[model samples]
Target: MAEESTKSWADTDSESSSSSSSSSDSEQEEVHYLIDDQTSDDEVFDFSNIEFTREDLVQALNDMVHEYKTLSHTFEEIKAENASLKNSSAKSSSDELEDTDSLKIELSKLRIENELLRSESSELKAEVEKLTK
Candidate 1:
């Protein structure tokens, strides 16, 4: 009789564990479906049915805060890099403008010298014609 009782108890324990595992599997499926569903912006999330311990909630909040801090640091780094690129671009533009202005001045000076040389050549040509005549 004792042996029979032991066997019965063993069977019950196995059955209970199997049932609990099936229920846990079903709960996970429900959670996955809920996460996959897309809702409109006006819809609010309902968390009343889900169960969580206080420690779980606290851990989740801490994780979110850590993520926010990491993202904030990354954003600041990007802003600094953008500012540096802008400053470099502005300096390069200023240098190009200065070079262009210098080139224009040199061209104007060359044009004035060319006119003076042409006038001198014409005077020399007239003197040569008078002497030959």
Candidate 2:
């Protein structure tokens, strides 16, 4: 069983190495083809025939300004929402602090009551002993 396991591991290692080398070779070929395609594509686009008019420039600028206004409005809304959430968080934190203080006060009161009960119990026990005597 041990020998079979070792043999399978070695086979897997060799298969992985061979697959990796094959993949690398295919990647190199793809890169070479991409380079050739890019050079061929670059020669096809003749930028000398393209023209830009004044109207086109004005339209593009107007579009940019409109988009900026929309974005600014959205940013202000998000900021207002963020401020509202921070205010609520602050209110809740103060409430939590008050609750913690109240709990601490209750705990101290309970401790004192417990001590009183213990002392009264000891006094009753002493009285019972005296009665028996």
lDDT of candidate 2 over 1-133, digit per residue (tens): 3455556667966776777777878876886676566655554333222464434445555677799999999999999999999999999999999999999999999999999999999999999999999
List the pairs of residues colliding in candidate 2.
none
Off by more than 4 A, model 2? 1-50
Candidate that scores best on TM-score: 2
lDDT of 2 at 79: 100
lDDT of each: 0.76, 0.76
Tell how far residue 57 is off in model 2, in angstroms: 1.6
Clashes of each: 0, 0
Segments of candidate 1 deviating more than 4 angstroms? 1-46
All candidates: TM-score: 0.56, 0.59
